[model samples]
Target: MEQKDQLLQKVWLWSLLFFLVAAFTGFVYRWGLIGGDILGLRMSNVRHAHSHLMFFNWVTPVPLVFMARHLMKTAPEAYSSLKWCITVIILIGFASYPFFLIYGYHPVQIGTANLPFSVMLSGLVMIGWYWFGLIYLKYRNKADSSLSQLFYDGALVMLVVSSLGAWGVAVAQFGNIDNNLISGALTHFFLTTFTEGWCVLAAIGIFYDLSKKNYSLPVDKNWLIAPIVLGAPLMFPFGLSVDLLNESLLWTAKFGSLLVGIGLGINLWYMARALPSRNKVIWLFVLAMLALKVTIQLSAVFLPETLWLGQHGLRVLYLHLMLLGFVSTLFFAAFHTVNTRSSKAGVYLFLGSVFVLIATLVLISGLWPPAWQPTNVYRWVTVGAILPSIAIAVELVVAGYSRFKQG
Candidate 1:
């Protein structure tokens, strides 16, 4: 038990480091928005680095650690395999940051061959996921068929399936496919399924595992898994190049969006019911963002004008809501359970920054009333961006201090 706790603790701290770096990269991206250039980095490239680090390092590892720990409880013999898989995943994740930051998917000449450095690195990350998935499958039968297990299995399937979308992207680039529809569809598919499918499912699964003792009401086994599996692939249409989509693809995407909304709504309802008696406030905030995220998606699909209002801006808003708002906050709450010494000042600052960031994004998206629009939109957003990093940095300081005292 001590060993398991130590492993989880190490993994959790590593994730926090990733989160801090990603947050600071985000700060840089926001600075770029306000015309602040450092080291001649393109905003788009910096953004690619920031977002990938968040997905590959911050969000991906924490959930895997929890799920792997869950499996270890049931199948002790699989411990070494799971541990090594996680180690590889973290290494690959950290190694990926510079490739993306420097190259951003552009092909690099390696002797005679021109290779996309980040793309190759992304492929390795995908392999790491598959490696983890296989480990889960090997020990899955030994584990009980419970809600958390259902979510973990489904999340792994999505993780594998999402890789196909990434491969599609590589094929499009390598084959020199010129059609906007193909490229746009593949990109959105990869982004949507990985974020909505893998991340969301994994988070919910972690929640169930972490708070299982608090769950009193019974949930139907299939209710949570079926909708996401059926909907997420088709749901990519929501962010595709709408101009390139025909009527058939358009309606299909909307239908998928509806299914996804229903699935998330069901999960939220049950999760809300299962909330632990303590930390209800933070849990509710995360749930609210999840609710708002889907609601905005559905609206974007059904109302063409609504999509127009924030099409570009809303996508950014949506990703943050999912990654930072929903997934990151949930991770923080989970960490708080293990380390009660986390700074309250840091926690409040982080939460406040999230809401401020969301608000500025909504305003920037043209979703807010014209009268309420700020004169300098970029300035507001830059401030919003800076706050989260400051908050995270404070937490890191406290964590380091605590560890030093322990040592």
Candidate 2:
């Protein structure tokens, strides 16, 4: 058991290092988008690099560490496979994806088979997910079939499912297919399942896992499961770029938003009661941002025009709410659990959270129909985005120098 804890501790540490890069990429992405020239590259390229590295690299793998806790308990072999898979995630997600940034969209060919860098990375992800999914299935029925586990299971399935869409993307790109609908559906399918299923559900599961320990808070399994599982899939229409006219898709999108709202709403109620007493301000800040994300997301269903908001400034903001606000915050909580901390760490985390929150507000304010955005708002957003990077740097240093402690 001690060995397992120690192994998981290193896993979180490695995950955080990759997250540090993801945070750095966030600053670069925002800086590039806001008209700054750092690498003499277009914002789109930076955005691609940022999103791929952050989402596939940091967001997916980090959560696996948390999920592994349960895997270790029931299926040690699965946990063993997961450890190696994480190592590969670090290679592809951290090492290779960043390499893609350095060499953007340039696909190498072997025997007339053209391969996009993303396509290659996607292959790696599929391989990782195969191992992950198989590992989970090994003792899934033997494991607890609670809401948290349900989300974890769903997320595992989605990872494999999204990889199929990813392969479709590769096929389209390689075939030089210019058909918008084909590519768009493939892209949307991958993104929707990944973001909603893997990212959001995993974060929700982590929250439930954390909440289990709090005497003041009790998790309602049904509340966590129903809306997210049922409603989250509906939310994917937002990712579709091809068809906004289909009545069925439109209504499904709206209903999905509502269900996601209720699910997250239930989460906030329980988390609110539990976090404060634990002095988990970081968790509080993240859960609050999640509320904002769902509210804004679902609002698009009611105020259909709000769908246009993503065109303005909400795209990156929405992504951040899920990536940093929901996903990374949970990782931070886990990191704090693994490592002993000093007062300086708390201050760093608090200030970092404040900056990130302020940045979100600033970005939301920058949305169209209300353009009184703060002058040089990008600079403030950079500070907010980079602050966490700096905080993580400190934490990484502390973790590296400090001895392992009990969870």
Candidate 3:
């Protein structure tokens, strides 16, 4: 038990480090937008670095750690493989950050050979994820099955499906393919499935497992799982380049979006009912973001013009809402559940900063009236970015200091 606790804390600290670096990179990107040219880095590359770092490192692996804890209890024989998988995943994920920031996905000359370092690193990270999935499958029969397990199964399958989209991207780049439709579809496919399918479902599963003790009401299992698993792939191509999708594909995406919204609405109802009364506020905020995300997706399905006109800004806003506002806060609530030593003030600060950051993103997302545009939009965004970064850094430092004193 002590060993497991130590490992969990180490993983948590590493997650915080990754998150802080990503947040700082985001701040730099925002600053570069305002001040032009950050340390001679291209804005596009910096943006890629910030986003890829957050996706590959912080959000992807942190939940895996928590999920492994539950799975470890079920199938203790899988412990060694799970540990190594997560360790390699984290190391490879961290190594990819600088390469992405420097070159995005472009090739780098290495000893007279041009190598796509970031893309190669990303491939290795995906392999680690696959290994993690296989370990769970290999040990599945040794464990009892439940609703949470069903969700994990779906999440892992989505992860694999999302990787195919990612591989398509690498293939297109390597083959020198010039078709914009293929590239756009593949990129959007990967982004949507990975975020909506893998991240959201996995977080919900983790939360369900962690908070199952509070449940007295009966829940419909299939209602929660079917839509996400079947719908996420269909919904992927509904992004910026809708021209790539024919009418059938577009309607498929719309139907998928509708199912996802309905599924998520059901999820929100259960979550609210099962939530412990003590710290319901943060979790409620998390649920609110999830609801708002569903509303936005439904609007895109019905009002197609908004999707085209506000593609850049609205897309950015939606991603932030899912990643920062929903997944990050959900993780925070889970952490508070497992580790009561986390400070309340720190919790409130993190929560408040996340709210501010989401609000700032909405203001700049072109959703508001033109007359309501803030003059200092960039300044507001910068401040919003800084608070969460600072909050995370302080929490990490405080955690380390406490461990040092204990040692």
Computed on alpha carbons, the lDDT of every model, listed in order, comes to 0.81, 0.68, 0.82
- Give a tens-digit lDDT track for model 3, residues 26-104: 9899888888568899889999999888988898888788767767776666667778888999999989998999999
In candidate 2, position 366 carries an lDDT of 48
Candidate 3: clashing pairs of residues: none
Clashes of each: 0, 0, 0
Q: What would the per-residue lDDT of candidate 1 be over residues 1-407, giving only the tens digit for each residue?
A: 34555567778877778888888898898887778975898778889999899988888899898888788778878878888898888888888888788888898788999978888888898899999988888888998777888899888888888889999999999999998888989998998889889999998887787664655545567877789888888878767765776778778877887888889888888888887555678778888888888788778667874436426877788878888888888877776665665455666667778888888888867567779877887898888888888878776777667656655
Which of the predicted structures, 2 or 3, would earn the higher lDDT when compared with the native? 3
Scored against the true structure, residue 279 in model 2 reaches a CA lDDT of 38
Q: Model 1 scores what on Cα lDDT?
A: 0.81
User: Residue 225: error of model 3 in Å?
Assistant: 0.8
Query: Candidate 3: what lDDT?
Result: 0.82
Q: Indicate the TM-score of model 1.
A: 0.93
The C-alpha TM-scores of every prediction are 0.93, 0.85, 0.94
Q: TM-score for candidate 3, please give it.
A: 0.94
For model 3, where is the 10-residue window of minimal lDDT? Answer: 304-313
